[model samples]
Target: MTASSPTKQQDTNHFDPSAPPPFKVADIRAAIPDHCWIKNPYRSLSYVLRDILVILSLTFIAVVFKTSLWLWPVYWVAQGTMFWAVFVLGHDCGHGSFSDNPNLNSIMGHILHSSILVPFHGWRISHRTHHQNHGHVENDESWVPLSEKTYTALDAPTKLLRFKVPLPLFAYPLYLWKRSPGKSGSHFNPYSDMFAPNERRYIVTSTLCWTLMVANLIYLSTVIGPTLLFKLYIVPYLIFVMWLDFVTYLHHHGHEQKLPWYRGKEWSYLRGGLTTVDRDYGIFNNINHDIGTHVIHHLFPQIPHYRLVEATNAAKPVLGKYYREPKKSGPIPLHLIDNLVRSIKQDHYVSDAGDIVYYQTDYRMVGKKVE
Candidate 1:
C-alpha cells in the first residue's frame, strides 16, 4: 500500500483513541498462518543455548585478556546486548511460549531472568499488566506519561532526573524496586500492588532466587577483586538496564506522531494494543530476539519471539491500519537518540479529562520558552 493510502495512513500516521478499531482482532489473528503460532520447545531451547554460549564466550575472552581493561568497553556492549536477548527468552517462557509444559516454562523463566537479577515471576506478573493495558493512560503498566498536574507536582530535582539522558536509562533497577510514580509496587515485593494475593508464593520464590544470585555475585566479588568484579558484572548489568529502558520506552513512546492513550468507553484490547510501536535495531534485531517486532507481540504475547517477525508480516494486511512501519536503524540504533530526546522534551503529560489523550509539553517544567 502507498504511504498515503487511507488504510496505511491509519497505521502509520493516525491513531484516534476515541474511535473503535476498524477491524476485529479475530481477523488479524486469522491472517497469521497457523504455523506461526506453533511453539517449538527445541527451537526455543536452541535460542536460550545460543545466547548462553555467546555470553560465556565473551566472558572467557574478557577473563583471558584480563590485563587489557581496554577491552572492557567492547565486552560491555556485546554482553549487555546478549543479556537483553536472555530476558526476551525468559519473557517468552513467562507467556508460556517456550513450551506446552507449565513447570518447564517456570523453571526456564526463573533461570534466565533471575540470572540477570530480574525477579522472574515478579516481572512476569507486572508485564502481564502491561500487556493487558498497553495504551490505557490510567492503567498502563509501564512508560505511560504523567498527567500535567502530576508532572507539575514533581519537585525540580525529580523532573530533571526523569528526563535527563543516561539517568532514565538506569531506571530499570529502581523500577524493579519501586514501580513508576502514582503506582506503588516493587517487583521484588509480592505484597506490592502489582500482584494478587494468590500469586505471592511465586513472587517469593523469584525474589529468593534473585537474592541468591546477588549473594553469589558477592562471593565472586570477594574471590576476585571488587574492581574486576565491577568490570565483569556491574558494567554489563548497567548496560542491560540501558537496553531494557531504551527498548521499553521506545516501544511505547518515541513515534514521530503521538500515539493515543485511551480511557473509559474508548478503550478495548485491540485499540490499546495498536498504540505500541514496532522498532528496528538493524543487526541487533536477531541478537535481541526480534523484540523490536513489538506490535505483534503486544497483540499476541503467547506467540514466541522467534516467530514475531513472521506473524507481523502475515498480519499486516489484516492489521492494515494498525501496524506502523518501524523506523530504520543502523546496527547500533544511534538514530533513536533523537527520538528519545524529542520525546523526553515534548511528551511530558496528558490531560486528565480526555478519553483520548496526547502528551503536552510543559515548557515551565523544562525551563524552555515556547514560541
Candidate 2:
C-alpha cells in the first residue's frame, strides 16, 4: 500500500516500475533549477516566429520547384516535420509553458494549430485530460491500450487497421474526428462528452477556427488547382499526422521494458507520470524542440520545451532506475522504426482484472499461438 511496497504480482527484477516511486513529485520538482520553471514570452515568441518563417520558406521553395518530381517528396518530409514542430510550440502554449500570459498563449495556439487543421482548445483540453490521467487504464486519453475484452470484441478489419503498421501511422486525423477505439467524442464537437458545460464555449471557438482553416484551404486549392494543393498541402499534412502519431505512441509504448498501466488504488499522479519514457531523436532532439525529452515534461509540463533537457538532467539522480535512458540515434531516427513495428505487433491489449497491468500480446496478431 505504501510507495515502496511491491504489488501482488511483483517482478523479481531489481526495480519494479509498478511499485510506487521511492521519491515524491516534490522531490523531482526541487531537483530542477528554478530558472527551468520560468516561462519567457519573448523567447517563446521567437520560436513561433522562426517556425513560421521556415514554413513560409519551405512553401516558397516547393512552389518554385513545383514541376520537379524529386523535390516534391523532399518538400513533403521537410514541410511535415516543420508542421509537427509548429504543433509542439502550440502544445507548449496549451500547457502554459509558452509564456505566463494567457491571451498570448491562446492567440499563438489558435494560429499555429488552426493552420495545421487542429482544433486548438479542443485538443488542449483533451490533452490536459491525457496528462492528468496518464497510465490509468480506463481514463488516459492518447494511445492507451485496449482492454482484452474490448480488443477481442473488435472485428477483424478493425483489429488489422488498429494493429497494422502503416495504417496506425496515419491515425491522427481519424483520432481528431473520433478519439481512439473504445472512446467517443470528436475533438471539434462542443456538445461531445469530452467537455464540460463551461468548456463548451472554448470548444465552439476552436471548432470554428478549425472550420475556417478548412474553408481557406478549399479556396486556395481551387485557386491553385487541386493537384498542386495536394502536392503542397495535403501530402505535408498527412506526413505531419504520421509524425504526431509516431512520436506520441512511442512516448507511451515501445519501451524495451514493458510499462505498467494502473487502475483503482494503484494509480497515483507521480506513478502514472513515471510510466512515460524519454526518447533520443538524434538531430531531431532540437529540430522538434526536445519533445523527445518527455518524461520530465509529463511530470512538470509547465517547464518550457527549451529547458526540458536541463530539467531532466537535474531530476535524473532522483529518478534513478525509474528513468529509462533513451537509446541514442544516428544522424536520423531510423532505429525507432523497429520499436514502432514491434510494439504494434505485440502490445495489443491489457487484462481486465488487475489493478496494475502491462500490455498483453495478442499472439494471433503476430502469427503465434498462446503458449
Candidate 3:
C-alpha cells in the first residue's frame, strides 16, 4: 500500500469508488495465504538490535562527535523511529494482541513504553476502555468527546489548558495529565487522570514498569555521558513519536467516519469498531501489526496482532458502506488538520431516540455525532 495519495492526488485521481473499495478488509483476510503466519522473527529482533546499536552510537557521539551539531539530527532520526517501533509492539501487548502470553505482553509493553517515558499502565487502561466503550461519549477512554456547552462551561483556567501550548513538542508534556485519574495529576496536571477507578490497577503496573526502565537511562546517562543520552537515544525517540502520532491519530480522528453513538440494541460493537479507520502505511503496516486493520481490532481486542487482517477481511462484506480503509500517499498533515478542524469545536453529546449527536463546526444536524 503506497502511502495514500495527497489530497491533490486524490482530487485528481478521483478515488474511483468503483475500484472495489480498494480491497475489502474481508477479502484481505480470506486471502492471507497461510504463509503470512510463518511469524517472522526479524521484526522484534531487528528493532532490539537497533536499540543496542543506537545506544553504542550515542556513547560514541559523546566521546567523538562533539565538535558540531551534525550528528544530532541523525540521532533524532535513528532513536525516534526505532523506539517508536518498540512502542507499537507495546501497544500489541496491551490487548494480548502481540503474543498469547499475558505476562510477555506486560513485560514487553512496559519496557517499550517506559523507555519512551509513557506510563504503560495508564495508557493500557485508557486504551482498553477505549476498546470496550469506543465512540460512547461517557465511558470511552481518552477520546471521549466534549460538547460545546461542556467545553464552554469548563472554568477559564481549565479551558486555558486546551490552548496552553502551540507547538506539538511542547504540547506532548501536557498529555501526562490526560489520564482518567486526577489524584495522580497532583503534580498538577489537570488532564492527567482519564480513566475510572476500576482501571487504576493497570495504570499502576505500567507506571512501575517504566519506573524500573528509567534505571537504564540513569546508568546510560551517568556512564555513557549526557551527550549520548541526547544524541543517540533522544533523537530516535523523537523521530519514532513523529511516526507514532502520525499513524494512531490519523487512524481514528482524521478519518471521515463518525460514530453513530447508539445505545442498547442500536449500539453494536461491529458498528462502533467500523468507526475506526484503516490506513496505508506501505511497509510500516507490517511493523504495526497490521493495526491498520483497526476496525477489526476494536471489535476483537483479544485477536492476535498477526490475525487482524484476517478478521478485517472476514467482516468486510457485512460492513459494506461502513467499510472505510482509506489510503493516501500525500502529506498526513492535510488529512489530520481537516479532521481536527471537525473535532475540536465539539460542545456536547445529545441523545436522540436511539442515537447520539454532536454539535460543532458550523451548525450541525446529524454529523458524526461526537462521542
Candidate 4:
C-alpha cells in the first residue's frame, strides 16, 4: 500500500517505515531544485585541492613538531580525518557527481584514491552495487547483516572480530582484500565475480595504481625510517579506515528504531535507498564534505555533495516518515560512539525466510543466555 500524499502531515507514531512510500521517487526528485542537480566540475575540483592542501599542512606541522609526544596523537587524528575527506571527494567522482566529464572523473578518482592505496574502480563498482541493492539481504555489497543460519554457523573468533568494538572498526582493509563473510570476490582481483568482463580493464588499472602506492609507501618507510613513516602515514591510514567503517556501518545498521532489510520481491530501489539513515558528524560535517548526509546521497547520488542538505530539505515533504531525521550533534559527536557500541552488541542477524525483517540480537553475544 502507498503512503498518504505529500501534502498531508504524517502521524509519525503510526508511520511504518517499511511500508511503501506514498509518494513516488519522481515526486521527490521533482521537489529538488534544478540547481541542486548541477555538477560543477570547478567546485568539485576545489574540494579536492582543498583537502590535499590540508593533508600537506597537517603533515608539515607534524614534521616540525616531531619531538612533541602530545602533538603526535593530535596529528594522527587530524591527518586521518583529512584522508577520509579526500576519499569522499573520490567517492563523488565514482558517483559521477563530481563532474559531467567522464575522463576527468576517472583521472581525479585514480589520483585521490590511489594516494590512499584504494583500488578506485574496484571500490567504485562495488559501491555502485551497494547503492543499487542497499537493503537487500543477499545482494547488498557492504555491511549487509548475516542471516540467522549464517550467523549461527560463524566461528566464535569470526563473530568476535565482526561484531566486537575497535576490531570491527578496523575491518575495511580486510573487507577490500576479501569482501564481507559469504561474499567471494577481492576488490583488487580484476576477474572476480564482482565485476563484468568488460570492467576488468578498469579494475586492473586501479589495482595497479594501488600496488604502486603500496610500493611507494614501502620505499618511503625504508628511506625515512619505519617509525617516522608510521607516524606520518600508517597510523593515519588506519584511523581513516576506522572512520570509513564506523560511518558506513552506522548508516545502515544502527538506529533507535529497528530498520528493515528486504529480500526477494519486497526489495525495490526506492525502498532500499530509503533504508539508509543520515548522520550528524558535528564539526566534521563540512570537513568531510557532508558524507554523513547519507539518506539523500543514497536516494540521488548524482546530486553533488555540497547540495545534499538542500536536496534533503526539499524532498522531506515527499519523504514524510520514510525519512528519518538524524540526531543532532554537538561540537564533538561523542554521542554516536554510544550508538555504535550498542548496535554492535545488538544487531547481529536477520531471519532466513522473511521478505522483510529487522535485525535480531543474539542474546549470547550480549551476555545473556540464548532462549
Q: What lDDT tens digits, residue by residue, belong to model 4 across residues 287-343?
A: 999998898899899999999999999988888878888888688989899999888
Give residue 199's lDDT in candidate 2 (0 to 100). 99
Model 2 misplacement above 4 A:
1-13, 369-371
TM-score of each: 0.94, 0.96, 0.68, 0.95
Q: 249-351 in candidate 2: lDDT tens per residue?
A: 9999947677888898999999999999899999877879999999999999999999999999999999998999999868787989999988888889988
lDDT scores of the candidates, listed in order: 0.85, 0.90, 0.55, 0.89
Clashing residue pairs in candidate 1 (N, C-alpha, C atoms within 3 angstroms): none
What is candidate 4's TM-score against the reference? 0.95
TM-score of 3: 0.68
For residue 250, give model 1's deviation from the true position in Å: 0.3
* Candidate 2: Cα lDDT at 53: 95
Please give the ranking of all candidate structures by lDDT, highest first, separated by commas: 2, 4, 1, 3
Leading candidate by lDDT? 2
Residue-wise C-alpha lDDT for candidate 1, range 74-154, written one tens digit per residue = 999988888888998999999998988899899999999999999999999889999999899889988877877788788
